[model samples]
Target: MLDLLEADRAFVAENEAQILDLEAQITARQRWIDLLRDAQRAAKQRLSSYKYPVLTLPNEILGEIFMHFLPPYPDPPPLVGNLSPICLTHVCRRWRDVACKTPSLWRAIELHPSVHRLSNLGETLSLIAKWSARSGHSPLSIRMECRRQFDPISIFTSLIPHRARWEHLNLNFGSGSYIQTLDIDRPMPLLRSLTLTVWDAVGTPLPLLEVPLLRTVVINDQGSPSLVLPWSQLTSLTLRRTHPGACLSILREASQLLECRLHLWSQRTPLGGGAVVLPRLESLVFERDSEVCREFFESLVTPALRRLELPEAFLRPHDVETLKAYISKSGCTLQSLRVTALASLIQQILYRMAFRSIPTITFCE
Candidate 1:
């Protein structure tokens, strides 16, 4: 009887030990499950934060912000896709969507090929076409500059088809062989302002650029036979490094011209002996290369001229006296005079002008 009792006791002890081991295993598993659930909740919260936040901005505010990223009109600044994409798009999806939809934000298309490659020419043109189409009949101002090798004829031809949509055209051909190959015969009926910098003297005679609404014309080269200025409505004229003889002819034709800028280089020819009567002229700018500025100044006969900008060069006492005498005699309404020269010569000129009580003079050294 005692052996049986001992055997029962041993069996009970073993069973209890087995049950406790099972309970510990169950507890460890429950702990693991709790840890897994906490991890899963944290992951869900992180994913939710990553989801795009809703932006509640008015359309006009969004438009204005996008406009800040846009290029100025009448002349589109260069676009590198860096600012609009990387800077703005990275902020949020709403910003990306707004940037993508703002047509004016993308309307500025720059064709200056120096910053882009020839392979990109097609892409650039396509971009311009897209922007013009998106502008919805709004007049476009196109600035095309080619400083390296390019097909000027091809470029001009491509733009000719869109001439009716062009409001302002700025062409800079600084260093390129193709500059001479441009075909300017195509008329830009809607062109209001034209700026041309021709490095090469090639191109067919420009057709009558008879934009009756044209107001400003800037030609920065010796007058070329290929270029025929439509001067009937020209109000502002700027001639930089131009042939003196041709410029005189242009001035004579632009009888109603109001503002004039003449930047004469050393190699430019002196104006011929003639009296140019600019009856309505108000401002005259003379940026000279040497003392020969006197010759260029003497060529003009502007009775109503009010401003004079002299060159930065050493002038003898006699030369200063001569300039003062000339201004005293002709420029009765000369209100402002800006003289630029070396320090010593400028002081001497100022002293002479002051002694004569010539109208206010500003010296630039």
Candidate 2:
């Protein structure tokens, strides 16, 4: 052991001078690298200090320009593309900071749970939370659509706190959705427009949508008789896949409607002589496979009706006569008639009926 220790000491003694020289070289090179890094950082800073024309603009002016970068309202900007808000930050740090502070640029949120969730809901929720925060106090336009096997309960819960900020809410849930009861028990003060297209809605009706400022609504559902809303305040309504009897019931309460469109098949004809007088109705369009039957046709009294569109398949036996009677009873001077195609039969009928001044017929394909 003593001989081995002596041999190791002799080897260390010989290499000590070489090890010290290598350490000195390494320390000097490190010092040089540190100096080079400092110089590079200073040079970059000086280069950045050079005046660029756009960066000279004030923060407010930059904000205005950023706003122009966005598409029109109701059309959301993309999230990650070159034209997206995310790209605005890639230009420079100043633009990044400015965009981060501009709440309006990020106020629109559209979440497709089915498309995004690949068994990672926590990540999706994190993204939504961050995006919603950037909106700050601006009113929100939220669209939540789930088409497949995904439960959106956590996502909905994340948005519950921002209910008052909701200006427009669109929800289209699909198969295996966990939304059994959508409780809108909270009053949405800023909500103006709502579009709901629930395919397999829960048996229980959605909670009464207590929104005072709501003026326009589009529901693409079978029927919502139990759905409570301020029906009297609606000015424009468009419904798809609604029953005829249910349509009359809604129109009865929606006397304030100016423009209304219904696209659906006939379920139950309101054969009972019931009429719904829409005093303020101006534009009425019954498009697609809308069954404009006798009972439904005779029930409308739209004196202010200016533009009327009938469906392509709306040629029952007495449909034309019922339309004439409806026009006569309403006393509305027909200005324009919009139909899918102007058949010769309809033209001959119009001529034979001696319709008052064959009002400039227009075929709207």
Candidate 3:
């Protein structure tokens, strides 16, 4: 009986040992299974990130995408709107970091300061300062239009500090009060395009000879004599609300002009001078003055002229003959002609036949 009992005990002990060994093996396998599951989850996360590139795109790549979101540089987006770069800051934290660090995004600014509203001026100035700060050392394109009310000096004061970066600047004011406050006497190294317009002429002339890089200019009647431009260097010029004499005088100096647009204030061609010969002039647009622009038309000799726009009245008493003579004199192969028609059907037909050699001709009444 004792031997049988001892055998039973030995058998039980062996079975217990086997059970413990099995438990140890099971625990090891379970640990490996858990580790594999953790690794699989991490890999899945990586795959999802790859699928959505914005999630994993480096900040530099994201910044480039942000740049495409705004208008091209030198053309400003609104200071505050969906189109504004400021909208990018409202996104995730990472995106905000990327946008704030991109200088080009904040380089252009457009401001309209209403004199009627005294309240918004402060806010506008704040935004201008903010953009200036965010732009870093990048060149600036600034446009400001102030209507009716005087004194937008504060706005000018804000921008005067960054004059070195003025690339494409356009300033329009209701009166000339703002012109004196414009501290543009300092050199604008990067200034390429400039537009300055005001209603009443001020004694203070805006001498902009310091802008060596200036190529394009647009100014009004008040701006004509008041602003001294680097006329010879200009490639494109637009003069609005100017006298015939003044217009001719400017054209005489702008010898390098490839394109010119003149909106004459009167038909009186006061001075009898030689034709304002522009050898390189390619396009000429003469917006009708109060009277006929016949004399003005007779004044230009552009050999390189390809496009001409003027009133039919400007072609004068002998329209076809005048145009034929003008074309002959210019030695220009006019590719396009646009005429503001105020002529009878017979006259129009004759004009059409006369200019049939021109590749494109359009008439608008």
lDDT of each: 0.66, 0.74, 0.84
Greater-TM-score candidate between 1 and 2: 2
Clashes of 3: 0
TM-score of each: 0.73, 0.77, 0.81
| Model 3 stretches with alpha carbons more than 4 Å out | 1-51, 114-119, 147-151, 267-269, 288-291, 342-348
Per-candidate clashes come to: 0, 0, 0
Q: Judge candidate 3 against the unseen true structure and give its global Cα lDDT, from 0 to 1.
A: 0.84
Write the candidate numbers in order of decreasing lDDT. 3, 2, 1
- Compose the digit string of candidate 3's lDDT tens values, residues 1-365: 99999999999999999999999999999999999999999999987767455867888888999999988878888788778899999988887888889999999888765422435667877888889999999999998887544246777788999999989999887777667677776799999999988888777787876898999999988876667788999999999888787888888999999999888777443667878999999999887543566787798899999999888888778878998999999999999988875546776677778888898887777
Once model 2 is optimally superposed onto the true structure by TM-score, how far is the C-alpha of residue 272 displaced, in angstroms? 2.1
Candidate 3 or 1, higher TM-score: 3
Position 219, candidate 1: lDDT: 77
Give me the overall lDDT of model 1: 0.66
Q: Per TM-score, what order, best first?
A: 3, 2, 1
Structural RMSD, model 3 = 7.1
The true-versus-predicted C-alpha distance at residue 224 of model 1, in Å, is: 4.0
Per-residue CA lDDT of model 1 for 1-365, tens digit only, reads 99999999999999999999999999999999999999999999998777332455665687677677655676575645564322565677777667666666655556766565435557656755655665566676777776445555566567666677677877776543344455454566777777877775654555545576777888776334547777757888888786566667778888787888877555345567686677788888776453344555656677687776776452344656666566555654777777766467657556655545546777666
